[model samples]
Target: MPPIRTFTAALGLAAMTATLLVSAAEAAPRNRYVQVQGADGRGYVASRNAHRTSSSFTANRSIQTNGGYGLNRNRSAAYGEGSYSGSSQTVFNSGRSINRSASVHDNGDGTASYQRTVTGSEGRSRSVSGSVPYTPPQ
Candidate 1:
């Protein structure tokens, strides 16, 4: 009877430790910014921010130069309940840009469907979509 009680206590302690470990792994949001300039008045500035969780994440970045050139980009995604969706876009000061998006959903029959699209800087767009068998990671 003593051995049985000891085993049970050890199991309970292990469960609690596992829960705390999982909680500690969740990270907080982060942000960064930087700028540089020279005596010649030529310089650039940049910034980035990001956040993440057990199921979702989002991020963006931007850069600007003193020569009238600039760039911006953004992306985000989330997954849960057998589905996922994400999109991204990038643009430049010269009117050139690219955009993309994708989505996937489980069919509940051991397969999943997906769709994706991409648009280039010249405004020409292309898309490809298909389905495949899905196996969730253990």
Candidate 2:
């Protein structure tokens, strides 16, 4: 081929390749995050796109009261390639110095589970575990 024709063909091929790459990147999933603060509490949320098919979600909250009560919660759902997983935890403290907590997880392939725990200022502790299906809302 003549030098001018060869150069034109190469340029065209390069342009096409660039366009494909840009399209793929645009189709890929991305992560997003948000946070908020209230007069007595704070919260955060996170999510990510997954393989142009599904998405992951996460959130957490913390709060306190002048009477010495406190509450906290954290949760997350993650998707990777062909699999997904989720977890959650919550803790509450009574103004009288007693505390309780619970945690849960979804293994994403048909299995789910949880754990619960309680503690008191007197150094006593209690815990439990179980399983249940977990699904996120649309």
Candidate 3:
């Protein structure tokens, strides 16, 4: 084939391959698990699973100790169309927990509105909401 035709074909193949690679990377979630044991018979297990795309992500993690102490947490977030939102919760085996959530929205005038809330183990909750001028990093 002519040099021009060959170059075009190579370029097309490269583009297709890049697209496939990106798609495959985005389609699979990453996960990890680990366990450790001590000579004294104390051990702990931990695991985490996370999935992410260009604009959104979610993740969860948990750990348990042999002494009946454990913690688990989950979080997720997304951003699009000038808005973002996220929330998370963490719990322990001792009946204590904490929860939090937040959201922000662009006001279309160089400002964004935000609201956030947090709750403690005793079920007491507090919230703060306001707007602020936003300037993204250079």
Candidate 4:
């Protein structure tokens, strides 16, 4: 009877210890980020904060290449319930640069209208607006 009681007490203590350790390990959420290998002679890396289902999302990414005379690129984007927006910039080793920004909004009828602005190293900027129908992939 004494041996049986001792075994039961040890088992209960072990279970409680395991539960405490597991809970302590679950800490807070960490921000999300990703890095991808080379694509078309360039590599990309990006990161964003974790968002709940009801919250909007924003992310930033950059791409660059190695060796001499490579190019660098940066971009950021955001998404909300009925709209999305983004911007990007590219810089070349030769001291040339180009920047672009774009936004899109839903039209409530399975289509969206978008506007885009672009500026080049020559300091010229232009904007374009158009609409496109949306069809989900099969």
* Model 4 worst lDDT run, 10 consecutive residues: 50-59
TM-score of model number 1: 0.71
lDDT of 1 by residue, 3-42 (tens): 4433433332333223223342565887999999977899
Top-lDDT candidate index: 3
> How well does model 1 score by local distance difference test?
0.70
* Candidate 2 total steric clashes: 0
Error of 4 at 100 (Å): 1.4
lDDT of 4 by residue, 3-86 (tens): 543343333333322322333234333365566667565555555442212222233333334434445666655555556666
| lDDT by residue (tens digit), candidate 3, 51-126 | 8765676899999999989999999876656566778899999989999886776677876666678899988998
After aligning candidate 1 to the native by TM-score, how far in Å is the CA of 60 from where it should be? 1.7
Better TM-score candidate (2, 4): 4
lDDT of each: 0.70, 0.46, 0.72, 0.54
Better of 1 and 4 by TM-score: 1
Candidates sorted by lDDT, best first? 3, 1, 4, 2
TM-score of each: 0.71, 0.30, 0.75, 0.48
lDDT of prediction 4: 0.54
| Candidates in descending TM-score order | 3, 1, 4, 2
